[model samples]
Target: MNAIPPAVQPPVNDEIDLAALFHSLWEQKLLIALVTLLVGLLAAAYAFLATPEYQVQSMLRPAAIKDLDALNRTGVYELTPEQAMQRVGASLESYDSRLAYFRANPGLFEALRQPNRSLEQTFESFNREAFKMLQPDPKKIDSLSAYVGIQLTYPADVNGVTLVNGLVEHAIQAEREKIAADLQTVIQNRLNQLELKMAAARANYEASKDARIAELLEADSLKRAQLQDELKALRQQLKDRRDNRITQLDEAIRIAKALGIGKPTTPSALGEGERVAQGSVIRTEVNNQQIPLYFMGSEALEAERNALLQRRSDDFTEPRIAEIAKELQLLAHNRQVEVLNQRENEDLFLKDLAIWREEATRLRNLSVDVTELKLVSVDQVAVDPLRPVKPKKALILALGVVLGGMLGLFIALLRNGLRRGASRHHSDQSSLSS
Candidate 1:
């Protein structure tokens, strides 16, 4: 096999060729110097001629106007710092809001726009500048704390400090008004509902009282009628018993006299010996002692004893009926107590409703009071600053020097590459001719 020709390779150095690089740069020093000088001059001119911007900074804390109670019930509390920042950031970011802001203060962006500009041109020019000046710092926003920071840059003619304060005021007022209006509507509706409920409760209580009174009256009338009938029967039976007893005593005395067993003149003598033996009204013991006890006629005595036994038997059902009636009345009494308790519960509910109404009214009033509230308090106010915040001359010039040096180095390397290619071409041609 024929030996393969060696591959042509560019020279490689493990160590950097410092001397050759310096020589090459020296040879093309004029071009490098000219290019570096041009870039530096341009940077210097920009640093001096550009309009300086001044920044107005202010720190704000959004005060909590309402307490925890408001948060739980109506959620009509004051704006927080996070919310304030969001509103401000949104307003600045939005095209329409920014446009409106620019319109309100016509002179704010007048310097940026040329004369006789179209509406679109004016808006575009305004937005270009507004975005640069009004943008919140990414570093600051990322590490947000309890306080919101506002920084706006403007030209010397515009008052950036006044613009920041005004923006904050407007945002706070708008948010407060929105929340307050919503809370008021909710409060009114709740109050109306509470009033209706209270009215119903009162009417129910009255109806319940009237019905209970009617029920008690009817029960009392029924009980009174039953007791009156019982009393009348007892009185009539007692009178008949008294009259029959008297008639029985007279008949016994007449019978004794007619039978001649007890003579009117000799009753005492007959009663002692013969009265008991004959079963008369007066009786005598075995010792001839007369007793005052009297006996009815046999038929009457038997009939009356039978009637008494019947009366005792009748008393059994009357007592049991009365007992049952008493129990029924007790049940009615218990029901009346339950009704009273129910009315009491309704009264409690009404009282609670009244309290709820009062609370709603209080919240509504608070909401009204805070309708146009200034929730943000300026902890640090901005003033018209005398010094310019931008166009840092020292930093710009330093960066220009570094960039210019780097460009000069690139140009030197390019010149060195061209010189190396010419030398290599000459050597190749000489070798071919030999």
Candidate 2:
């Protein structure tokens, strides 16, 4: 009998067996398509059936003003730009503050608790998502000048835009009040400091006035004493000069008599005798009326005494000295006037300082009851948004198509490998039996 040749195993395909693989896949194309279609349909249905959520968005720009300008506008606080922004940020971040705000305006949060009848459930839902609607953007938190973005996600049924707007306004008002309160505290502290300074200034002004008065009094007394001493010295000097002149006149008259100068009946001789007799009187007439006599020592003595009398005549008399005393009194009066002027000037300065202090105190104590304090400007307020933001149908459908196609291809490849393995096993068994 002819030896049956051992069943020869097929050679391993060096490259992919494209023809056979294509034929196998084509035979199972119905199964693959059915599986892919079922998966795609299921995914599409799920996507369309899911509830859609809408986004309520807004942006708040913190509009800052100068501190003095803010004070001018509000008449209550010296609020800085940075502090204003910080106050808004604090309101946005504070959960308790927001809760309190919502509680105050029940209308704001009441409508948001729809579909849930239980109070606890409503609160849980509000705390979970609704309360977070007015939070500041994390990216722009560090940069105070940048606009703060606000986003709220809610079901399509809710009026998210109107709700967000209300919340934004509420938050802004809360922050403004907070800022005003803080500034009031600051002003109070500053007022306290000003009160102390004003007290010290008043004390200093009082002391200065007292010191000036004392100085003026002392100066007036000293000046009066000096004037008295000057008057006494001038009077004594005039008296001594008067006595010396009289003694010289007496000697001249005796010399004339000793020289046998008899009184002549001429006008020139009579004038000389009269001049000799005039020196003995308290007051002398114009000496120009007298004539000179040339006899023994009488002529020389009369000339010397006349020269002494003329020199001494220019000396201050009682009336002239009294005029000088009046002038000194006038000078003292002028000094006192100057001191009074200085005091007046000091008083004026104190008056102006007091006025300034009073004005500052008025500003410090000024009450500001702001019904509205606008810290932030809404760059873009949320409008009634119609379109839903979540549950993207197109994306879901595309993903479903790709995943279903991959799964169908995997099943097709698996079936082909199983068929090949079974065929190889059956052929080997037939070869063994033969």
Model 1 misplaced stretches (Cα beyond 4 Å): 1-17, 45-54, 62-145, 153-159, 178-190, 217-374, 385-393
- For candidate 1, which ten residues in a row score worst on lDDT? 291-300
Residue 312 shift from truth in candidate 1, angstroms: 29
Alpha-carbon RMSD, candidate 1: 9.8
Clashes of 1: 0
Best by TM-score: 2
Provide the global lDDT of candidate 1 against the true structure. Answer: 0.62
Note each model's CA RMSD in angstroms.
Answer: 9.8, 10.0
Q: C-alpha displacement of 402 in model 1, angstroms?
A: 2.5
Candidate 1: which pairs clash? Answer: none
Q: Which pairs of residues have clashing backbones in candidate 2? A: none
TM-scores vs. true structure, each candidate: 0.53, 0.56
Candidate 1, residues 69-96: lDDT per residue as tens digits? 3433455444454565566545545566
- TM-score of decoy 1: 0.53
lDDT of 2 by residue, 1-434 (tens): 99967777666554658899999999989878888888889889988888788887877775656323645564545555545555665666566765665566666556566673664556456666754434446766675555565677877666677777776777778766666777777677767777777777878877876787677777777777777777777877777877776685666568576755544233444446545554555543454555434242455556666766666443455676877678677756656546555664453567457675776767666766543555666778888777777788888888888888888888999999999889878977886676
